[model samples]
Target: MILDFGDGFFLRQATVADHAALAMICLKTGDAGKDATGREDDPDLLGLVYTIPYQVLEPDLAFIVDGPAGACGYLLGAADTNSFNARLVSQWYPDLEARVADPGPDSSRWRGSDWLRHKIHHPDFAVPQALAAYPSHGHIDLLPQARGKGIGRQAMAFLEQRLAASGSTGLCLEVMPQNVHALNFYRTAGFKVLQDVGLPNRCIYVAKQLGFAPGVAG
Candidate 1:
């Protein structure tokens, strides 16, 4: 275990065997930090797109949040966004595109998990120039049972330390503009909103500088 939160909650390195649990957690907290089970038809698609790839492609930075019941959350990161995006395009997306049919470009006719299906086929691997300074990126999600117990704070600190130890000078995360709680949490965690980035209307980028000492191995 990487961390023991006590009361039967802990953090551990995630493995491929935990894919199902990760998918369920992704679906449960999929809708802008709310449960999206009712809205998604193919519930696992969100995890396939967002969470699973981290464990498969960057295992060192992927971890699971386990409670008494089971895996309830995840912390995932990419130390280098450019390399990670390239790997996703070359090694990950082709297989996924073949497995999932495109839902087409028309949003009006889309339903259920159609949006995610479209994203799979037409994946965007671009990293905005504004985010170039923060070349590393991360994601963290916790179920309600794991929140309010200082888990999120500890998890973020853990991720930051990992990235810093790996020589990452900066780290960034994209949050939905509507998720006020997340935005606030990030701000409280020392992340600042990046201004003047030409991102889509849906995204808000928050970033922080990492203190990487020389000669440290991740």
Candidate 2:
């Protein structure tokens, strides 16, 4: 299912068998140096981000970067607001009151999109409003080896096409303002920031409209 985006790279839906490669990709992307909690290590929070989506949903919302060796990147989407996993946040973060648990909250912290977005984006036992307009949205990541290969651009385009064919009106995602490089990348790809999420990392929600029916084949 590799999509030749030209320029020597392609995007494809990830499979269950890709767990190992995807795990490695997560390590590289989530790597945040070393730590005792064993969470704020490399490749950072990407592992937590990717794994939750993959474990909760499947084929409908996961894409990957394929090159000469294996998966170099991945994009994940979770459209269903009532998903069981969405309700399991408490289980993962039982110490919700421990916001100040870390001495350096400024660093080694992951942003949870503010409560409002969570309320709207992650409703209880009901689909989100955005799903009617956007349906599915998630993050994209590319390994260092696959950087500058146009895989990210091709991936966004491909997902937009696929989601549109599946009846999605648009796609949404967020990026840290501090990540100027990533902000520029999504901007270049036609995504615009919609609002500030006000998380620890200062994330901003961005979206791209697909003005057509979804799942249109390329």
Candidate 3:
């Protein structure tokens, strides 16, 4: 086991070379932070939806932690939510059509497959309320082994710093309302919480304004 201490793991910009490992991490971390290997026969679906887009479209914003074993965690996101969604519909989804399957009553399939089927046609976008304040949004996942020891915090800080540097007004991420651990982590990282507005799928959007010179009205 690679210890969390120095020299055991390191964070780096993600590249095509890390694609397979990143996909596996997406699958393993798919089930609300638990392994989704048993939940989906199509092991690649989760990664196809969540992990691969940023790799292809916005590589500079995506990062990964290399553990002694393999990829321990990653954070990836879009700098502009609206533009990213438009690109996903116009450029990305067409190529993925061949890989999709009809989401039927298959308890064996990953829930992400159903989402993939729907979003291919429906083209969902980020919450208007969220985008109004924070145009950039990110998604992160860390393997159980990667938790604690501040790796997640480092990864988050990396994104926050990068976004602030890029002149973003704010940044946001969708957290499950039930995932108290993730909520706490994000809160500690300086993100502000908004009351759950009863959205579908129970996603809670949290955000933080970038470069808020302290004590100034935001």
How close is each model in CA RMSD to the real structure?
Answer: 3.3, 7.6, 3.9
Give TM per candidate: 0.95, 0.64, 0.85
lDDT (tens digit, per residue) of candidate 1 on 16-121 = 9999988999999999999999999998899999999999999999999999989989999999999999999999999999988998999999999999999998
Full candidate order by TM-score, most accurate first: 1, 3, 2
Best by the lDDT measure: 1
Each prediction's whole-model lDDT (CA): 0.91, 0.58, 0.77
lDDT of 3 by residue, 1-218 (tens): 22233567877888988788778999988877788888776787678778888888899888888777878888897888888888887778887775675565554653745755655545566456534667788988988777887888877777878888888878888887777888898889988876545444557778888866445335
Predicted structure 2, TM vs. truth: 0.64
lDDT, model 1, position 92: 92
Q: What lDDT is obtained when candidate 2 is compared to the true structure? A: 0.58
